[model samples]
Target: MHPPDKNPHDMRTAFRREFASPEVWITRTVVVGAAAVAGLVVVGFTWLAEQALGLFKGIASVGWWLPLLWTPLLCGAIVWTTRRFARGAGGSGIPQVMAALDPALSGGRRPLLVSLRLSLAKIGLTSAGLLGGLSLGREGPSVQIAAGVMLTARRWLPRGSGVSAHSLLVAGGAAGIAAAFNTPLAGVMFAIEELSRTPEQRNSGLIVSGIVLAGLIAVSVYGNGTHFGVIHPGPIGLALVGPGLLVTLVTGLAGGLFARLLLASLRGTSPDAPSRWRQRYPVRFAVGCGLAVAVIGAVTGGATYGSGNEATRALLDSNGHVPGGFALFKFIATWLTAWSGVPAGIFAPSLSIGAALGHDVAWLTNYPYAPAVIALGMVGFLAAATQAPLTAFIIVMEMVDGHGMVLSLMACAVIASTVSRVLSPPLYTALAMIQLPPRRTLPLATAGGDTDDSATRP
Candidate 1:
């Protein structure tokens, strides 16, 4: 009687055997294939960006006249593209990612074409912005470009793929940032801190995959060197720690305030509102670029005109005697560059300015351990400015590659972040508020409220 009765499990076993399937292995193969393709695309994009920048540099070297013509025209083109295609690409594009991923904004509606066009627009505009001496950084453009690419690819997938697309876009963007700056950990941290604004992100698996792929691509191309050259152990002292902490707090607060002020100045509705720059089309941008170049050139002799990597190197190495208010000039240049709607990132420029400011503070005050103090300030100010302490700390540590600065960095980061919050929200978040619809923004007037509270917590 027992032998005569076959259980459902036995029937299923026979069915499984009949299929002759290797589901797990096949799935693994598919995953590996997708990852390989994504990795190649990321690397290729980064390489292209660098090449584009080199070409810009070559053209500009011919004469200062090139940028004079190039700045306004290129900026105008970027603005025009943003206006026509991805309205979200109008600013840094990070906020656009946040907006797209926001649950509140999704009325079961995701515009694939908008995303794709935005990415293309970002790449062109950002590259052109770079050529035109905009103070913006490449990380923003890289993220936008990656997001756009992934956005285009997701169009072929099923309808429910929007979430997946968003996650992948965010991951791809992180990879782009990681590759651009050669900071894999920072990339991952950024995805977690800034982009992964939901509980599901823990299991989404996209962040890890995208960051690792991007990091690998960056390392392969850049030979695993830290984005900034390693900092030599330069006169570390316990006495300087106290003063460094104070400076860090000030810088952080200033950074946050500066970011907020810039955002406020660049966004509005009325024709005469502070955000008139958005309405005037390219004219405001032309003026901004002209001013940035003029100020940077007149003050630093063009040394602080472009991205601040080379200048940062020189400043850190020189025991903190960079000329009169060069840091201040660089900060202004970056501010104007971003406010003018150039498609660029503030990541590098912000760090450069923070480092310079820190050094300047230490030098002026005759603070002991000037370099270490300044480095700490860099970490703190950057963290507060971006509202990303962990990413900022990791970035500075990786850039300098010295554990000696860790304690001071932490001190600076914490103080700066605390004070920064008191002053205003992070710059990018504030910028988002200005650019985003009123329904989309968190009430930034009050402090300690999470500006990103609308999105699910990462």
Candidate 2:
């Protein structure tokens, strides 16, 4: 009893008992296989989105007025398809995954939000929005798409497979985020912050494996490069406080306003003529929203269309060189795109808007740390918009390879999130709650039930 037996046969027997169990093998195979599949699926979606954007850019290049015609028609068709066939494939897609994972919802409703059909529909419809020059992101929708793939894998597994649906959902969604942005760390944080309320569960291994596999697919193709390349902003002395505060305040207010608008507009409680029309005739309203986006794109010389990836790059390359009011145009375009009832996301667009804001502030103030300011803008806006500061901060810091600005980025994220919270309840949480049954009013921990999407078209 003083010392445990060092018998080799007993040690081997115990090891086999733990590692060679049937449930262990099944869980490993099923979860890992699903993660790899989800990785491939997310990579395919990224390629499709890029191709769609390329097509839109090519056609728009032919005529400056092309998106004006192309966007409206295609967006109208997209909204029609989303409503008629895959009603659950609407919105940012993160909220849908969250709703499916919510314990408050019944199991029967889970399939509505995360299923094979919904994943396929989400990829197609979101790509359609991109092809039509809508200022939407595929990254947000990737959460639902990957989660759908993982959940589908659950059905193929045998009984007592060791992994719970909740674990699979969290892992797949986190994997999706990692695959989409090549940010495995953000994926883990997002799973903890937005996807799961019960973080005490021992799914750490599951979550890490999913992120690694899904993220590996992206790294295999892109060669492990940072998503937005790298940035070096020299040094920041005492000058950062004023300019940093300006950037944080602007992004915070702007992000909060964006979330507030999306809530009111999507909830059908805006009390505006556009909101009324959207509630009454959704497809027609989508057409109109598309028209607005096209006008913004044309006015911005096509800068306001697409996911703003290239624009953000150019902004990073050139210190605050974007056209005047570029952030405002992009903010409006992104909001309209989200409000159009299409299966798209505002995640990337929010980052793009923040970059514009940072650049504009740099222009106004003539700050030397333009790149740092831009990075701050990205984290601030994203954190404020999603109300997930850690995820936002990590995403920006990793994407830009700006680890040197870790403290600054973290501070900005916290400040922006605080400011945003004052104006709007959590955007993703509020949206997820609306996915619950209208009559039940389940005891979900959401800030606002005032937002009822039932009034809007599915």
Candidate 3:
């Protein structure tokens, strides 16, 4: 029997029909997959938190040397594992993800392997890094771990399951952020705005669904109230105007300068061409850890280690009360933490430092507007340093329950974000350039032969 000939119109209509239904099916699948992944991330992060807190409490119970010994061993293990198993685990995995998203790197490696190893290493190293009194935050590292999990799933999953795996990865990442901050909405926003903004624009629906489910899990775990019970929402007044604006501007400058200086110093100190400080990565990190030990030990009396979440609680509870220069010490430790190539995050530590500085300002000035200033500074500096004002604002607001200070926070956020942009593009952007592939010109071919348009083609 002869095959029936199909008309162009019928063929086009058929193609459209085929393409249309799959989107709905894929979206539904993504939603369910995201929910499952969110649940998994919540469970994983909760476990990590409990383990970390228990470990730290145990260390605190013992003498000082216990932490020193504990920290180095853990860091050493993590570093060794990363070097041996997955080199992507060395720094904040966000940069690696960015690299992975680039068209150039996508086809090279599965990217999922890098994600999985980074995740495992981050959990072990970050936890251990914390115990060692290293100044780092879990939130940033959590992203790496979450991505790593997704990557592993991709590597081993059935060939046809890639789409579902990608969806779940996005979901897991959002859930990780939610669990880390105990703020689900912020996590969702971050996933959408920052983490999932890829050139391909492939998993928007899956990511959004995952973020929602992850947020629900976070809310269940942390309660509906704000992450920090910041009940004192004062009115916005001229009283806070002068000091608030001044500090915000100053902090913006300081944050931008600080981020640039720290990155530059870290870059310059790379031990190799790729990283002037790469060769010294181990030693530089060790020295940074030693310095963190010294500075945090001396200033906070051992209270300033790890992410400083507890310290932040203590500071806020004390109504902007903190030991003088504690903020500076924390900042220095954070710089060392990232620069040392330790598998960790600077985001939380930066928030902690900003809060400390704001508090210090309030305490010294004897100002009643301490909370506003502290809240503003906490987010302002973060916005400036990260160059993600929206994400910074949302994360900070959710963490501190800064709803009432909206006017002040927003004003400062705008100023600080603008200042940061003006000062430098963003820390990650500069770091990405360092890893950018060399440009190459490939010859372009027409249907019949090579074309001169090759040199001009992007």
Best prediction by lDDT:
2
lDDT of 1 by residue, 1-458 (tens): 36654544576776674344464334333333343454555566556656666676677678766666666666666655554554455556666665556555552333422256666666666666666566667676666666656555554444433236556656666766676677788788888888776635432554476567667776887787776667764666767755676678668877877767665555433455434444444445545565556456445655555567766777777543456777678777777676665566777777778888777777677875556766776787788777778878888888878577777676677777777787776666655443333464432210111112222122
**Runs in model 3 with CA error above 4 Å?**
1-27, 65-69, 110-114, 151-175, 196-203, 265-288, 291-295, 319-321, 434-436, 439-458
Residue 300 lDDT, candidate 2, scale 0-100:
88
- Deviating ranges (above 4 Å) for candidate 2: 1-14, 439-458
- Candidate 2 per-residue lDDT, tens place, 1-458, comes to 47866764687777886688887677778888999999899999999999999999999999999888999999999988887788888888888888888787777878878888899999999999999999999899999999999999887676866577888888889989999998878888888778877653455686677778888878897778998889876686678878889999999998998898888777766778887787778889989999999999999899889998888887888643567788889999998888888888888899999998888887688997688898999999999999999999999998999889999999999999999999999999888877766546543221112233443233
Q: Estimate each model's TM-score.
A: 0.80, 0.93, 0.80
lDDT of 2: 0.85
Lowest summed-lDDT stretch of 10 residues in model 1? 444-453
Q: Show how many residue pairs clash in every candidate, following the order shown.
A: 1, 0, 13
Tens digits of lDDT, candidate 3, 1-458: 97766743677776775466665456556455645564566457556755775677677568765655655555555555555565556566555544444455444443432355456666776676666667777776666566555545454434443354445555556666776777767767766666554412454655566556666666776677776677464677777877787778867887897778656744444344434333435544555455555456545666667777766776667543456677877887777666555667777777877787777666666777566777877888888887767778888888888877766777787789888777776775555433334345332111000011321245
- Better model by TM-score: candidate 1 vs candidate 2: 2
220, model 3: CA deviation in Å?
1.7
Model 3: lDDT of residue 219: 72
Q: Which one is best on TM-score? A: 2
